[model samples]
Target: NSVSEYTKLQKEISSKRQSLYTLVESGSGNLTKTAIDKINAIRAEMSALEIKKDKAYKRLKIAKDAYADKIRSIKREELGQFDGRFVPELAIPAGTRYLANIILECKSYFGGPIEMNVWRGVAAYNCGLGRTKEWNGLPYIRETVLYTRDILYNLTRMLELKYAYSTGDSDLIAKTKRKMGV
Candidate 1:
């Protein structure tokens, strides 16, 4: 399935990124010409894999949308709102759209919401410490950890603000208040 392929490609990308980080941190001056050549090769391969991943994602999304449209058509017919040739556009709210993308990106690595939060926390901790540290008790590179932390933090903050405004949830509001030390 495309999902499994996407997951594999994501892992490959992560590995390649870590490898690239290691090479940069280790200093090219100490590396043999062959090692430098290998690094360039890895970089090129990573770029190609990224392009492949994007194509795979597009295919997956199209498949999902087709299935959803079919289900929606059936429901609309049952509700007496269907026309033979008309399909409604998929109109997701901006906040929900942003959150969905974040979930997808995280799920490629971390799976569900709770696991995603744990991953975020680990990244933040590593970033703040200014060194590579254990994530889920496994070593991760510092640069990637910091990048992941920023993405998670910004996405989480955006979702929290959106949900707090729309739902007026006391827990969300209180969490924000505590963050601001109110």
Candidate 2:
């Protein structure tokens, strides 16, 4: 059943992909969105395992960042703008560092509470500083909106876990861990 279902979804995605260019060219606003969403839904269903794995990876990243206190916010004097060069193919750490720097810069530019700044900075990171500022927070684009929402949710969860740890609340710790799927 699943194999057939997967094949069925694949065919659906293929057909949607075929129409996507036509939809774009014709400027069929809502129809284009409908087709894109349908294709994405099928892809998402197929990528469920990948989503789980990605969450696990995010948890590991959080743990690594916390355990080492490895990446303090880059100093204000040192936050440099991206030079539009060096897109490191295999250097994840380097790429993360670059993204983190952009976030720090965006936070400083936004000039609010640290937490809010981080949130805004992340939105800017996904979209762009100019776009995020123009929208006066998160842009209306679906991908950026979801990306920012997920990051904020993860950050909140991380804070809750830290509180649980600090307060010696085993029950909260266990509950949070369960929520975190780890």
Candidate 3:
């Protein structure tokens, strides 16, 4: 459930940091009114995200506590204490289901070959539907481009692994698992 939330927060932080850096760099000597305004806006966005991150951290702590409590309640031996490196997110599922729904939505809104629509949806998830529509496909943003590429590449590998499993070839399964780092 929190997978997308974490990813979104991380992307926003990177975007904001990059924007701030570019604005400051471009303003080298004289900071124009426009540049100052944009910098302020970026700072405001960063502040908002900081608050969001704080809330998310609190939620993470709550999740950790709940997980520990559940573990303690088990009838088996006491697990003792959890390490600082321990995270409850390991038990959480990925946002694949939500992203799948978004892909379907994109297909409905932007009708095209399912393959093209899937790319559009993936890009939309990285950026936004509005941005994707404006670009008529994936936006030129570097982060979005890489995000889409990585996701699609992983998905392709997943499909290949699935097919390998269906084939029931132990050799193929072993090779696929090794390739996928499974």
Identify the leading candidate in terms of TM-score: 3
Q: What is the TM-score of each candidate against the true structure?
A: 0.46, 0.45, 0.47
What is model 2's C-alpha RMSD?
A: 13.2
lDDT of 3 at 11: 71
lDDT (Cα, tens digit) per residue for candidate 2, span 2-57: 33444344444444444544555665455566766865765565466345545555
Q: What lDDT is obtained when candidate 1 is compared to the true structure?
A: 0.63
Runs of candidate 3 exceeding 4 Å displacement: 1-97
TM-score of 1: 0.46
- Least well predicted 10-residue stretch by lDDT in candidate 3: 83-92
The alpha-carbon RMSD values of the candidates against the true structure, listed in the order shown, are 10.9, 13.2, 8.7
Candidate 3 lDDT by residue in tens digits, 1-182 = 45467557767876797788878987769888989899999999988987886677677678767777776575433333543233334322344555666678778778876777888888988788887887778776767889999988998999999999999999999999998899
Which whole-number lDDT from 0 to 100 does residue 19 have in model 2? Answer: 53
Which pairs of residues collide in model 1? none
Best by lDDT: 3
Residues 1-182 of candidate 1: C-alpha lDDT, one tens digit per residue: 87688768877887898888888788846888877898999999999989998998988788777765875757544633543223434333543454454445445445456564445444533333223223432246434556666766776777767777687788878888677465
Poorest stretch of ten by lDDT in candidate 2: 81-90
